[model samples]
Target chain A: MKLSDIFKKKNSGDVAKDRLKMVLVSDRSSCSPEIMDRIKNDIIEVLSKYAEIDQDGLDIKITEMETDDKGTKSVPALYANIPIRNMHHTAK
Target chain B: MGEVIVITSGKGGVGKTTTTANVGTGLSMLNKKVVLVDTDIGLRNLDVVLGLENRIVYNLVDIVEGNCKLKQAMIKNKDNDNLYLIAAAQQRDKTSVTPEQMKKLTQELKAEFDYVIIDCPAGIEQGFKNAIAGADRAIIVTTPEVSAVRDADRIIGLLEADEMKQTQLVVNRLRPDMVKRGDMMSADDVVDVLRVDLLGIVPDDEDVVVATNRGEPLVGDSKSLAGQAYMNVCRRITGEQVPFLDLEAKKGLFGTIASVFKKK
Candidate 1:
């Protein structure tokens, strides 16, 4: 059998095998989930100073979608979306 | 003319002494002039492992304190003519000898032997510093567990801080059955996480326990698989291309077949 085929058979259903994938991804991206959360919070605070953004509508989450490498497991992607509905509000 | 290599693990019972004993024995078997130094201070056991505990007249502290010469403290291994051991002082504390003292002692040993392997005491304390002080390289031994790996990481960081150029790893006590069942981490997994050059991987063989109980190093046992792994590590230290043992193939017919071409 081919090497890739053998690797596929060996890696299937083994969640622990994702350790190297997760660790390398985090290391290469230079951002862990905790760091991403902290950055998200900082962004929210900074944007809050200029405009009023709805915390409830602000969808800040990380989604790991595989870009390429069809057979191999991919890293979780970080996603962020902020909505400023009451931007014209004045501080009283 | 020889290199001083320190075998260390931050936590106790991770097989630092056993590795030292086996590697020393293996190197000696290869006819290399090897000297194993027990730097555990108050907790000496390398001499016992080498079955030379009774022959140690002068310990490390005595030699360092000028009670005896360095040559007087070195007890020759009866089994292997080229192997020598410097036993630790079970009564003296680690503070008895400073890192500078260890450096001086090992410097002298380096001029006499082909390899000087120091069995470092557990923890990243004074004993650890003294053990690795004059070494040209280091081998960090760790098990495939979170706590051991964490401690190994800390030790590696400390070794880097000390500016040691040659630092490799030896992951011991790996259970192949568990690793195959996805219950335990494999040697590759440990290596990937540590991101260090792997010297060798030793399986969790019961022969190791038998060897320890018999007060003999497994590395010299012709039939023991763990013994062979230690030998492979010794060869790798001297720049050999020995492959890592595939623990998963250590059972039944496949094991026998794999063993035929397996790295020594």
Candidate 2:
């Protein structure tokens, strides 16, 4: 490797893209991760009372939705893929 | 029928008026009949930018209020017989004209002209709604800044919500020197964030200020880089596929060393 290659700089364009990506992720979600985290905790808390929910394999993520409607629409949608290990055995 | 295009920017002072004037004139120079509409009521500038401020008699409000005919209110360009202007009302605000009225007026103009380019006011409000009401397409102008790009993203969202199917972006005032130094955002940076189809990239040039102040669009000035850029945008708009302009800054000894390694 040449000595000049060692001093090669990270372009500002790359820096700008990195910064914008973080900002846009939050902007599109319209909420901070902390807020979403609290909401997720509350959901699990409430669900545990009704039935036992698998605590270890819970997945909740806020992401964009793609539509098949005629007019183009891009929006954030909450997707939760939770695995229920087993339901609480109830007594009749 | 004519195609109605509105040149807009969510934030102010990003060259919406300048882009409208140049693109309108550029299209007219290509033998396409174009009418430049100044929808920025109460703060009109397209006339001033186009150097037709002194010719305003019956304005947009006058035509909408039935006080004057559309042709009587339209001002013909001295440089190009095909170009015209419909100055906005300076005394009243944006509320004077409704979207329905704007739509009707645009339809009328479409029958007579090949293109009706509306110069939209900054901000997404009554002025913006009214501007796009008559527009079949939109051209968003933005500078290479975080604030400008953020506002542009919001605007693209709003436009998408409005079901505007045709929209493009034009990046303005890009300084090649600053871009080379990594001190400012480049065209690619803006495009990566905006995620809109690239329309044109106008280089930052001082000749634009002089030409704008003189009420002469730089599109006619062959020597001006900004003018040539606008001309290229015009050709692309007319269904001609033109490659983007090369605004790359010349590199020095250090840049040469880094570039040689970059290829490897």
Candidates' chain A TM-scores: 0.43, 0.61
Cα lDDT of all candidates, in order? Answer: 0.84, 0.87
Q: Estimate, for each residue in B172-214, the C-alpha lDDT of model 1 and write its tens digit.
A: 9987767766677778787877668899888888999888888
Q: Which candidate is the best by DockQ?
A: 2
What does candidate 2's lDDT look like per residue over B55-167, in tens digits? 89999999999998888999999878999999999999999999999999999999999999999999999999999998888899999887788778888888887888688
C-alpha DockQ for predicted model 2: 0.34
For A1-92, candidate 1 gives per-residue lDDT tens digits of 69778666764324344554554445545678698778888988998887888888887755457767772344667778998866645653
Mark the regions of model 2 whose C-alpha exceeds 4 Å error after superposition: A1-15, A32-92, B249-264
- Supply DockQ values for each candidate: 0.12, 0.34
Off by over 4 Å in 1: A1-44, A47-92, B252-264
| Worst window of 10 by summed lDDT in candidate 1 chain B | B246-255
Clashing pairs for model 1 are A63-A77, A64-A76, A64-A77
